[model samples]
Target: MMTDLVLIEQFDSRTAAEVARSILEANDIPVTFEADDAGEMIPHLAPVRLMVGSADEAEAREILSEAMKSTDEAGEEGVDGEPTA
Candidate 1:
């Protein structure tokens, strides 16, 4: 399908992709999942991808950015110097 906008987010795991998808849906944007065929043998292919249309590109990027920022912050140590990781 031809899209006016397409953004790619690489997730460390499939669950992360799903979470991202849900976030987009919750915000009223349409999302489509793309993945290498399970039956295919492409080792270099990503297992899952969350796709947002061109119209929602900006909002999608914001949502993804926020998710990544929160994830990064969660990995940092608190003011007391206790590492969350």
Candidate 2:
């Protein structure tokens, strides 16, 4: 019975926002996905906002940032120390 009402972070791509939303939800934090339909109408418009609750806002952003960092690190790594192909 929790509600999502905090604007935690914004991303240019829906994919990234979705990934962030998933991370917050997985961590037991309530999340709401707000798609930028306006951006869809105009690709140059503002990015989409990934919001959560006020109480969990800070924690959610930290979780998302950490997740993003881990993803970046993983992408930088490769099997046998070889670059990704």
How do the residues 1-85 of candidate 2 rate in per-residue lDDT, one tens digit apiece?
Answer: 4474878788887777777777888999888767756757764466778777788888887887798898888888696767786
Writing each residue's lDDT as its tens digit, candidate 1 over 1-85 gives: 4365485565645667779988888998888867674534552466666777888888889988898898788779777879864
What TM-score, over all chains together, does every model reach?
A: 0.69, 0.74
Model 2: runs farther than 4 Å from truth? 1-4, 38-44, 83-85
Instruction: Give the lDDT of residue 1 in candidate 2.
Output: 49
Model 1 alpha-carbon miss at residue 58, Å: 0.7
lDDT of every model, 2 decimals: 0.74, 0.78
Q: Residue 82: error of model 1 in Å? A: 2.4
Provide the clashing-pair count of each candidate structure: 1, 0
Query: Residue 34 lDDT in model 2?
Result: 71
Off by over 4 Å in 1: 1-5, 39-47, 78-81
